[model samples]
Target chain A: MQHYRRTEIIVGAFMLTGILAIGLLALQLGKVGGLGEKGYEITATFGDAGGVRNGGDVMLAGVVIGRIKRVTLVKSLKAKLTLEINNGIQLTTDAIASIRTKGIIGERYVRVSQGADEQFLQPGDEFDDTESAINIEDLISKYIFSSGSN
Target chain B: MNGVLNLFGFMGRGLLRTTERIGDGTMLCSRAIGHLFTPPWLGRQLVIQLYAIGFGSLIIIAITGAFTGMVLALQGYYTLAKFGSESLLGSAVALSIIRELGPVLGALMMTGRAGSSITAEIGIMRVTEQLDALEMMAVNPVRQVILPRIIATLIALPLLIAIFDVVGLGAGYLVGVNLLGVNAGAYIGETIAKVTMHDLLTGWVKSAVFGLLIGCICTFLGYRAVPTTEGVAQATTRAVVTASVSILIADYIITSFFL
Candidate 1:
């Protein structure tokens, strides 16, 4: 009976440790997009969103204030990104939402630059001034061609 | 014509035998799971088995996870450095461990450590007529014996895999940041940013399936072992091999759908 009790205690400890490990992974290591949070949705259209993925970061002044909610290719053959920005931050109408890469050859994120306009954009608003991701391949080809012609 | 006929017959028999074993294994799993609902809960037996299987295997899993993470960092650093992107090492190590190695290696290690023991124990029971003794005593041998082992394995494996992943990531951070000169902020940030609920779910699902596979394959081989010491040894070997291979095959199938 004592041996059985000891076994049960050890097993219980093992189970608790496992649960703690799982909790750490899910809470600390895993990323959850802005869902069921105090957030507003805003759309930004870009010519080429490139590597911008859903759940990608939305940075304002180098701080992540939100997440990229979704990425869809609209009928215009352009990428349409829906960003979920936190409640406190406000974006002016002329604010630019641009697809920017981290370092070189890193994951892409949306960077929203503040504008001079005093008027704040409401939820479901679309950014008129959006910049597409810079295609490295295209830049390389252009550089090679221009330099060769010279 | 006779030689060709013999070859065809041998192939057909082998195929049929394989199919028959699969069918028997499925039936055994269903019965064991069914017993889970119909109680006499066997809680004591389950705790005992959980200790034997899960707690016993923890050391091996941790060692494997730590080394795997360290090696991943070492290899990833050198490879990614060639492209001048050593910053991506954190993401590389975390992604590989979380998505692929964590569950698979955890399951494979469990199969070797616990699964072989499970087969041997049951095989010994058969050899000593203990299963028959249980039958004569009006206790269903399958219910009394197999059910708890399967249930314990199913409950244990996912938790072990979770532990494995955490230990591995910690080892990876230690290597990438402390040993090598990768930026700690970028390493951790990329890992946190790139890994989503989807990747975590993928690992959990794979681990659970592997748990089920290990439980069923080990128990089935033991239950069907010939009543001899040599037979028990062979069953133990076969159980480990089969469970390991099945985990890999199932991993590929599950990953295909998730991808």
Candidate 2:
């Protein structure tokens, strides 16, 4: 009986470890645990949004630094995308955004390339140097039809 | 030509015996399920079995969970590095463990540990005439002996697999972040972004079905074993083998439906 009681206590400890790990994992794995990091939103205008979808990643130098919040089409055949960046990420006013696909056939995300400038972009500022996704199909057809016409 | 004919004959009888055993096992399980609701709840026995199965199996499950996570982290890091996208390792490890490995491996371990013992224990009782004696004394052995174990397994395995998932994910974190120097935020953030409630529920559902498979097959085989020493031994082996095969087949079928 005493042994079983002790076993139960140890089992209880195991359960506690599991519960605490779950709490930590969930926090780390959910809500994008910013803890002290407050995010700020910025907008970018692109000729084409390509495959960059909402909730897609905003990456800088191969590291995910933020998420694409919303994508809307502009009347001038441009795409306007809203990005929410992590706290402490500073972007220059001349920085450029490009919608890069993962591979030949993969989802697209916005990659931010930094530029040398004394001026830094503030929250809600719009980036002017953005490239839309170059439609692969458009590129292929242009190559195929023009070459076949030869 | 004669040898080939003999081989076919042997296989034909083996298949026949296998189907016959399947029929008998089905009847055993249905009868036990029928007795499940008819009072004489065997509450104390259920508690005892739960302690024996759940508590007794914790250390192994924890160790397995940790190592599985660590191995996944190491393998995933190298694979993702090839693509220069090591940040996605967290999602890979989490999805694999939560959707498949945690439940399936945890149930397999439980079957090898607790289910095998349940078979041997009950098989020995049958060999020693204990079950027959209970019947002579007007005690329902299925209600008293089998139901408690089935109920205990049904309750215990989900808890065990949930622990396995949590601990495994933590181990992956330790290896990926502290050991390999992946950014903690990126590792965890990617996992959280990609994983959903559907993944979590799929693991739990698989564990529950595996628990039922282990409990029913093991207990039924043990209770129905012949009253002989060899019979008890064969029953134990058959219980483990049958329960494992059934768990895997059921896993594929259930995952197909989910997909």
Candidate 3:
């Protein structure tokens, strides 16, 4: 009986440790996505979003500082994405946000390679200069058709 | 005429026996589960069985999960590298582990390690008339012996899968970043963006069903095994084989529902 109780204690501790580890990993993986975390919103307008998805990461210098909150269509030919960024990081008024793919054929996310400007952008200010994700299928078809025409 | 008649009779007997066993097993599971929800939950037995089943198997689970993850990264890197998309290895590993391998492989490990043991232990008790002794004492043997084990498996299997997922991700990360030279940012970021709660929940639900299947099948086989040493050994083997096969089949059915 005593041995059983000891096993119980050990097992309880083991399970608790495992649960804590999973929780930490889940959060670190950013599955929570700023549900209750403090962040500021910045909207960026793009000529196209292609495969840029909502809840995707907004990265600066290979590090994630925010997530895409929403992707909306304005003027039927362009996309506007609402990005939720952490409070401490400041974006310059002339910063550029571009939709970038994770790999050759992977999900698209927004990367801000150079956001360093003398004048800083505010919460509601939009980053007008943006690059959209290149759809491989579209590019291939366009090439095939143009090559055939020539 | 006698030879042909004997062959036909043998075939008929085999069919009848198969149906009989299936019916008896169904009744055994129903009665055990029907009694499971009642009071007098054997708290001590549950704790003991939980330790025996869960804690006793952590090392094997860790090894299995880590090796599986490492192999996935190695293979996925080579395949994705053809397209210069090796950085997607993280998302690929995470999705595969969370959605398919984690629960299925974890349950298979349990079937081999714990399911066989449960069948043999209960079979030995039956052979020794220990279960009969409890019956004479007016104690519900099913509740005492089976319910706790069922509850233990139900709780332990999902958590085991969760641990498998975490260990798998870590192993994949180590292999991808250190050995394969995939960019670390793309690996982690794509996995976070792709895998969601829905995938995790599907795996958990499958684990629960697998737990119930393993727990009931092992206990029922042991309780009904022929009371002999050879009988107990055969029962143990059968328990493992049956539990493993059923887990795979159930996984397919559940995946179909999700699709």
Candidate 4:
């Protein structure tokens, strides 16, 4: 009976420890851009989202300031991306939204080019100047063939 | 002519014996599954097995996980920095550990730790006539001996994999952020942002299947031990080898299917 009790206690303790560890990790993940807190929302329409995925970072001047909240098709050929920008950073009405690659063959992220216009973008405003990410493989293939033609 | 025929006959008998052993092992696994759900469940036995398999194995798993993470971070930093793309470090380390390393390595470690011990204990019991004694007493040995180990293994393996994932990721962070002076917040943030539910779910699923394989193989090998101490020792060794090979093969199959 004592041996059985000891076994139960040990198993309980081990399971409790595992649960606690996972819980702590989940909490940490939730705090930083996972749950999308304290960020202003904006929209961008693009001919293609390219390889952009939800949870990809939104960057300004090479610094991550927010994340892609959701992606949906606003038209048959146009995709709409909802971005949650970090608070305290205001964007102009003329700000350009472009998809950029971090490294060669790396994942894609949204890059917001700040505009010089004095007018601040209101909530739910959409950026008109958007650039889809350039596919390097496609570019390389095109370059090789096009250069041969020339 | 007679000697040549005898040689062919010997080869055929050997093949037949091997096939018979495999069939018997399969039948044993099926019956063990049936016995697992039937009445008079051995909760106490299962709890003891769980402690032995789970709690006792934590320190080794943690150490191995941490070392693996540190190495991944170090190597990843060197490789990515060469291309001036060190920011992808988090995705590389987290995806590799969570998707592949954590489940497979943790299962292999448990195969060495818990798998060998379970096989030896049951093999010894078989040689000592304890199994026969239980059968004579009308107590189902499968229910008494096999079920607890199987249940404990299935429950314990997932927990072990989870521990490996968490410890390994933490180690990667320590090496990448503190030791190497990468931005701590960004490194962790990227990992969390990139890791999806599918990545974690796939690992846990693999762990569960590996657990079943280890338990069934070990128990089956042990229960069929020959009636001698030497035979019991041989069966125990065979159990570990067979379980390890099956884990590697199954991992490949699972990866191909999922990936």
DockQ of each: 0.61, 0.21, 0.34, 0.42
Q: Chain B, model 1, TM-score against the native?
A: 0.98
TM-score of each: 0.92, 0.75, 0.81, 0.85
**Which candidate wins on lDDT?**
1
The residue pairs that clash in candidate 1, if any, are: none
* lDDT by residue (tens digit), candidate 4, B20-43: 988998898888778766687687
Better of 2 and 3 by DockQ: 3
> Model 1 off-target regions past 4 Å?
A31-40, A59-66, A85-92, A119-123, A140-150
Ranking by TM-score: 1, 4, 3, 2
**Candidates arranged by lDDT, highest first:** 1, 4, 2, 3
For model 3, the stretches where C-alpha displacement exceeds 4 angstroms are A30-38, A41-48, A59-65, A69-82, A91-106, A111-150, B1-26, B183-186
Error of 3 at B56 (Å): 1.3
lDDT (tens digit, per residue) of candidate 2 on B56-102: 78788889999999999999999888877887888889999988999
Which 10-residue window in model 4 chain B sums to the lowest lDDT?
B195-204
lDDT by candidate, in order shown: 0.91, 0.85, 0.84, 0.85
Q: List CA RMSD, all candidates.
A: 2.5, 5.8, 4.3, 4.0
Error of 1 at B117 (Å): 0.2
Docking quality class, candidate 3: acceptable
- Write down the DockQ of candidate 1: 0.61
Model 2 lDDT tens row, A57-141? 8999988888887898889787899998888899999999999987666568899999999888999999969877879999999
Per-model chain A TM: 0.78, 0.74, 0.69, 0.79
- Count of clashing residue pairs in every prediction: 0, 0, 0, 0
- Expressed as tens digits, the lDDT of each residue in B1-259 for candidate 3 is 9999999999999999978987988887788778867786677888888888887777788888998899999999989888877767888998899889988998999898888999999999999999999999999888888778888888788777778888998999999998888888778877876677667768778888998889888998999999999999999998998889889999999999975
Question: In model 1 chain B, which range of ten residues has the least summed lDDT?
Answer: B188-197
Error of 3 at B61 (Å): 1.0
- Weakest 10 consecutive residues, lDDT, candidate 3 chain B? B192-201
